[model samples]
Target: NLASQLTISKSQPIISGIDDIKNGKVPGNRIGLLVGSASLEYYLTAVSGGNPNYYPLYSRDQIYQNLLGNKIDVGFIDTGNAEYMTNDVYCNLTIAGSGFN
Candidate 1:
Protein backbone atom coordinates (compact mmCIF):
# COMPACT_ATOMS: atom_id res chain seq x y z
CA ASN A 1 0.00 0.00 0.00
CA LEU A 2 1.21 3.42 -0.89
CA ALA A 3 -0.15 4.85 2.34
CA SER A 4 1.24 8.34 2.66
CA GLN A 5 1.52 11.46 4.79
CA LEU A 6 3.63 14.59 5.26
CA THR A 7 7.32 14.82 6.15
CA ILE A 8 8.34 18.18 7.49
CA SER A 9 11.64 19.87 8.20
CA LYS A 10 12.55 20.16 11.84
CA SER A 11 12.68 23.91 11.56
CA GLN A 12 9.15 24.11 10.19
CA PRO A 13 6.14 24.35 12.41
CA ILE A 14 4.20 21.13 12.93
CA ILE A 15 0.67 20.92 11.61
CA SER A 16 -2.08 19.74 13.94
CA GLY A 17 -3.34 16.97 11.68
CA ILE A 18 -4.24 15.90 8.16
CA ASP A 19 -7.38 18.02 8.43
CA ASP A 20 -5.18 21.08 8.35
CA ILE A 21 -3.96 20.03 4.92
CA LYS A 22 -7.40 19.15 3.57
CA ASN A 23 -8.77 22.43 4.91
CA GLY A 24 -5.91 24.43 3.36
CA LYS A 25 -4.34 25.48 6.61
CA VAL A 26 -0.73 25.42 5.44
CA PRO A 27 -1.25 27.86 2.63
CA GLY A 28 2.19 29.39 2.89
CA ASN A 29 4.05 26.09 3.10
CA ARG A 30 5.80 24.66 0.10
CA ILE A 31 4.69 21.08 -0.45
CA GLY A 32 6.98 18.76 -2.39
CA LEU A 33 5.21 16.05 -4.36
CA LEU A 34 6.78 13.11 -6.14
CA VAL A 35 5.64 12.96 -9.74
CA GLY A 36 3.28 10.13 -10.63
CA SER A 37 3.26 9.05 -6.99
CA ALA A 38 0.26 8.08 -4.89
CA SER A 39 0.98 11.03 -2.66
CA LEU A 40 0.64 13.34 -5.67
CA GLU A 41 -2.62 11.68 -6.61
CA TYR A 42 -3.86 12.16 -3.05
CA TYR A 43 -2.89 15.81 -3.04
CA LEU A 44 -4.51 16.41 -6.38
CA THR A 45 -7.69 14.68 -5.40
CA ALA A 46 -7.99 15.38 -1.68
CA VAL A 47 -5.64 18.13 -0.58
CA SER A 48 -5.07 20.41 -3.54
CA GLY A 49 -8.44 19.62 -5.11
CA GLY A 50 -6.85 19.98 -8.56
CA ASN A 51 -4.99 23.11 -7.62
CA PRO A 52 -1.20 22.83 -8.15
CA ASN A 53 0.43 24.82 -5.42
CA TYR A 54 3.33 22.41 -4.95
CA TYR A 55 6.82 21.64 -6.15
CA PRO A 56 7.04 18.54 -8.30
CA LEU A 57 10.10 16.35 -7.82
CA TYR A 58 10.70 13.05 -9.60
CA SER A 59 12.08 10.62 -7.03
CA ARG A 60 11.85 9.36 -3.45
CA ASP A 61 15.43 10.51 -3.07
CA GLN A 62 14.41 13.94 -4.23
CA ILE A 63 11.82 14.08 -1.50
CA TYR A 64 14.47 13.60 1.18
CA GLN A 65 16.88 15.93 -0.56
CA ASN A 66 14.32 18.69 -0.93
CA LEU A 67 13.21 18.42 2.66
CA LEU A 68 16.78 18.34 3.98
CA GLY A 69 17.82 21.15 1.68
CA ASN A 70 14.89 23.26 2.83
CA LYS A 71 13.67 23.51 -0.73
CA ILE A 72 10.27 22.39 0.47
CA ASP A 73 8.57 22.88 3.77
CA VAL A 74 6.79 19.55 3.57
CA GLY A 75 6.89 16.36 1.50
CA PHE A 76 3.89 14.22 0.65
CA ILE A 77 5.41 10.74 0.72
CA ASP A 78 4.71 7.10 1.49
CA THR A 79 4.37 6.44 5.21
CA GLY A 80 7.09 3.81 5.53
CA ASN A 81 9.60 5.64 3.42
CA ALA A 82 8.77 8.87 5.18
CA GLU A 83 9.36 7.18 8.52
CA TYR A 84 12.67 5.70 7.41
CA MET A 85 13.78 8.96 5.95
CA THR A 86 12.81 10.93 9.03
CA ASN A 87 13.97 8.53 11.67
CA ASP A 88 16.91 6.85 10.02
CA VAL A 89 18.28 8.87 7.17
CA TYR A 90 17.47 12.49 7.75
CA CYS A 91 17.24 12.83 11.47
CA ASN A 92 16.47 16.51 11.23
CA LEU A 93 13.24 15.92 9.33
CA THR A 94 9.98 14.70 10.84
CA ILE A 95 6.84 12.92 9.74
CA ALA A 96 3.73 14.98 10.34
CA GLY A 97 0.02 14.24 10.04
CA SER A 98 -1.37 10.74 9.51
CA GLY A 99 -1.11 8.00 6.90
CA PHE A 100 -3.65 7.57 4.13
CA ASN A 101 -3.58 5.64 0.91
Candidate 2:
Protein backbone atom coordinates (compact mmCIF):
# COMPACT_ATOMS: atom_id res chain seq x y z
CA ASN A 1 0.00 0.00 0.00
CA LEU A 2 3.03 2.27 0.31
CA ALA A 3 5.10 1.26 -2.68
CA SER A 4 4.07 4.17 -4.84
CA GLN A 5 5.87 7.47 -4.35
CA LEU A 6 5.80 11.06 -5.63
CA THR A 7 7.94 13.54 -7.61
CA ILE A 8 7.55 17.13 -8.57
CA SER A 9 9.32 19.81 -10.50
CA LYS A 10 12.80 20.63 -9.20
CA SER A 11 12.11 24.23 -10.03
CA GLN A 12 8.77 24.60 -8.29
CA PRO A 13 9.26 26.89 -5.34
CA ILE A 14 6.05 26.43 -3.44
CA ILE A 15 6.39 22.74 -2.66
CA SER A 16 9.74 21.29 -1.71
CA GLY A 17 8.43 18.43 0.37
CA ILE A 18 5.31 16.63 1.58
CA ASP A 19 5.30 18.83 4.67
CA ASP A 20 4.58 21.76 2.39
CA ILE A 21 1.36 20.13 1.30
CA LYS A 22 0.36 19.38 4.85
CA ASN A 23 1.27 22.85 6.01
CA GLY A 24 -0.87 24.54 3.34
CA LYS A 25 2.04 26.10 1.49
CA VAL A 26 0.94 24.21 -1.59
CA PRO A 27 -2.74 24.49 -2.30
CA GLY A 28 -4.42 21.10 -2.08
CA ASN A 29 -6.34 21.81 -5.28
CA ARG A 30 -3.08 22.25 -7.20
CA ILE A 31 -1.90 18.74 -6.40
CA GLY A 32 -2.56 16.22 -9.16
CA LEU A 33 -3.23 12.51 -8.77
CA LEU A 34 -4.93 9.80 -10.77
CA VAL A 35 -8.67 9.82 -10.49
CA GLY A 36 -10.16 7.02 -8.40
CA SER A 37 -6.75 5.69 -7.57
CA ALA A 38 -5.94 4.21 -4.20
CA SER A 39 -2.69 6.16 -4.15
CA LEU A 40 -4.76 9.31 -4.41
CA GLU A 41 -6.86 8.29 -1.47
CA TYR A 42 -3.86 7.19 0.53
CA TYR A 43 -2.01 10.42 -0.13
CA LEU A 44 -5.03 12.48 0.73
CA THR A 45 -5.46 10.76 4.03
CA ALA A 46 -1.85 10.05 4.91
CA VAL A 47 0.04 13.00 3.46
CA SER A 48 -2.46 15.77 3.02
CA GLY A 49 -4.03 15.01 6.37
CA GLY A 50 -7.47 14.48 4.86
CA ASN A 51 -7.47 17.61 2.76
CA PRO A 52 -9.45 16.81 -0.35
CA ASN A 53 -8.56 19.46 -2.83
CA TYR A 54 -6.40 17.64 -5.34
CA TYR A 55 -6.94 17.70 -9.09
CA PRO A 56 -7.84 14.27 -10.32
CA LEU A 57 -5.96 13.12 -13.41
CA TYR A 58 -6.91 10.25 -15.69
CA SER A 59 -3.44 8.90 -16.36
CA ARG A 60 0.27 9.33 -15.60
CA ASP A 61 0.91 10.72 -19.05
CA GLN A 62 -1.73 13.33 -18.50
CA ILE A 63 -0.14 14.20 -15.20
CA TYR A 64 3.24 14.78 -16.81
CA GLN A 65 1.70 16.61 -19.73
CA ASN A 66 -0.26 18.87 -17.45
CA LEU A 67 2.76 19.53 -15.27
CA LEU A 68 4.83 20.42 -18.30
CA GLY A 69 2.07 22.56 -19.73
CA ASN A 70 1.71 24.39 -16.41
CA LYS A 71 -1.92 23.35 -16.16
CA ILE A 72 -1.11 21.66 -12.89
CA ASP A 73 1.47 23.02 -10.52
CA VAL A 74 2.49 19.68 -9.07
CA GLY A 75 1.74 15.94 -9.42
CA PHE A 76 2.24 12.69 -7.56
CA ILE A 77 3.47 9.83 -9.78
CA ASP A 78 5.19 6.56 -8.97
CA THR A 79 8.89 6.83 -8.26
CA GLY A 80 9.85 4.75 -11.27
CA ASN A 81 7.60 6.84 -13.45
CA ALA A 82 9.28 9.90 -12.05
CA GLU A 83 12.66 8.45 -12.98
CA TYR A 84 11.50 7.74 -16.51
CA MET A 85 10.08 11.22 -16.80
CA THR A 86 13.23 12.96 -15.69
CA ASN A 87 15.66 10.64 -17.45
CA ASP A 88 14.01 9.45 -20.66
CA VAL A 89 10.94 11.60 -21.02
CA TYR A 90 10.54 15.16 -19.77
CA CYS A 91 13.95 16.64 -19.18
CA ASN A 92 12.58 19.85 -17.74
CA LEU A 93 11.15 18.06 -14.77
CA THR A 94 13.10 16.54 -11.91
CA ILE A 95 12.52 14.98 -8.54
CA ALA A 96 11.20 17.59 -6.17
CA GLY A 97 13.27 17.81 -3.00
CA SER A 98 14.03 14.30 -1.76
CA GLY A 99 10.70 12.89 -3.00
CA PHE A 100 8.00 11.32 -0.86
CA ASN A 101 7.37 7.68 -0.15
Q: Distance (Å) between predicted and true CA of 7, model 1?
A: 0.2
Highest lDDT among the candidates is held by which one? 1
TM-score of 2: 0.82
lDDT at residue 100 of model 2 (Cα atoms): 52
TM-score per prediction, in order, is 0.87, 0.82
Candidate 1 backbone collisions, by pair: none
lDDT score for candidate 2 against the true structure? 0.74
Flag clash pairs in model 2: none
Counting only residues 3 or more apart in sequence or on different chains, how many pairs clash (N, Cα, C under 3 Å) in candidate 2?
Answer: 0
Give the per-residue lDDT of model 1 (tens digit) for 7-96: 888787657557777776676247889888878878888877798878889998988898788787778888878887788888988878
Give, for candidate 1, the lowest lDDT window spanning 10 residues: 21-30
In model 1, which regions exceed 4 Å deviation?
Answer: none
